[model samples]
Target: MQAYRIVRDDLTQPAVLALLQFHLDEMNRWSPADKVHAMAAERLRAPDVTFFSAWDGAALASVGALRDLGAGRGELKSMRSAPDYRGRGAGRAMLDRLLDEARARGMTWLGLETGRPQAFRDAHALYAANGFAECAPFGDYVSDDFSLCMERGL
Candidate 1:
């Protein structure tokens, strides 16, 4: 397996911010503005959210976050791989780290919201391959044509 460090990363770096903005912009393009569930940068830094960036050597390869939703539930948020590193293992590594974190925290379930545009097919496959299943909306989310809700029990 490829080796990369998944570290607790802050959004202070310009590159990180720019990459995250690109992720959000892509989401905006795929889904309606009202249906985009990506967390704002500031909110990603909140106490309940654990944000991480994957680093290969000195390069930031990807970013992801896990948010505690109380009562043993967790949510995956803001997963994005650097454009140059898209085909690499960054996304898988970040996801494994988040799953580890959630399991360590004794979370019973994990869930996420992702856009359903054709652009998101790879992401849909990734989540499904990782054991997520399509389900009704959870938490504050509502049914929407442009969004998909998925969950897996830990």
Candidate 2:
């Protein structure tokens, strides 16, 4: 695995914005609009959300965020790896950073809502490998055909 420098991002950099847009576009392409749960750049800038980007030297490799859901709970948001960075451990590195941040913040659980389509198969496997399991709808989400919710104890 290549070394990745993971750090908190303000979501204002052009590369970060572009990657986030790509992530939203891909999510929309793979799932219905109503079922798409990826947050926009503005939403990710909220005080409770800590956005992170992983870089390989000067190039942005991946992006993710952890949102405080209150009561010792947190949620993973906007996880995406650049096309050239996929399969290169950048995403996993970003996930590890987010999990570490969650634990540091005293979160007892971390959950995420992702697509159920085949396009998201790899994402499911990655989350599962990291100890997340399919769980009931969480937060404002409800049981849905196109959404898969997963959670892990911190």
Candidate 3:
């Protein structure tokens, strides 16, 4: 599989939106008020956000975003793999590419907020496997039982 990092407009609108909505639907199954859908949509339209898509042949396998927080800090936002692509390491591959891009841009730290509900156990394990450690909340997120904050210093 090859991964592509493209300008926002380079993405096919329906495909990208479908990926985002799928993630939102998955999250909503557990946390109804996560509000990540709106936030991701807004960020996807922002110039400061870098979005990447991983493709297997011509099929979109995963999507991930990295937002510049200024001062050498970056935030990971809206990372998900298509349902048919799960369990195939697409998420991990996409995350590794995002990390490389962030470091290339001179980011000193990477932070992300993820759901902490039982439904998110696999996600939590993914982050932990990549060296992200639990940390205090970052970005616009407040401390909540349903969410967790994690960071990895570059």
Predicted model with the maximum TM-score = 2
What are the Cα lDDT values of the candidates? 0.90, 0.93, 0.79
Query: For residues 27-90, could you state the per-residue lDDT of candidate 2 as single tens digits?
Result: 8888887888889999999999999999999999999999999999999999999999999999
> Candidate 3: minimum summed lDDT over ten consecutive residues — where?
1-10
Q: Rank the candidates by TM-score, best first.
A: 2, 1, 3
Q: Tell me how far the alpha carbon of residue 151 in candidate 1 is from the true structure, in angstroms, after superposition.
A: 0.4
Question: Largest lDDT belongs to which candidate?
Answer: 2
- Cα-based lDDT at residue 6, candidate 3: 32
Model 3 segments more than 4 A misplaced: 1-9, 34-38
State which candidate, 1 or 3, has the greater lDDT. Answer: 1
Off by over 4 Å in 2: none
In the predicted model 3, the residue pairs found to clash are: none
Residue 31 miss distance in model 2 (angstroms): 1.0
| Model 2 lDDT, full chain set | 0.93
- Count of backbone collisions within predicted model 3: 0
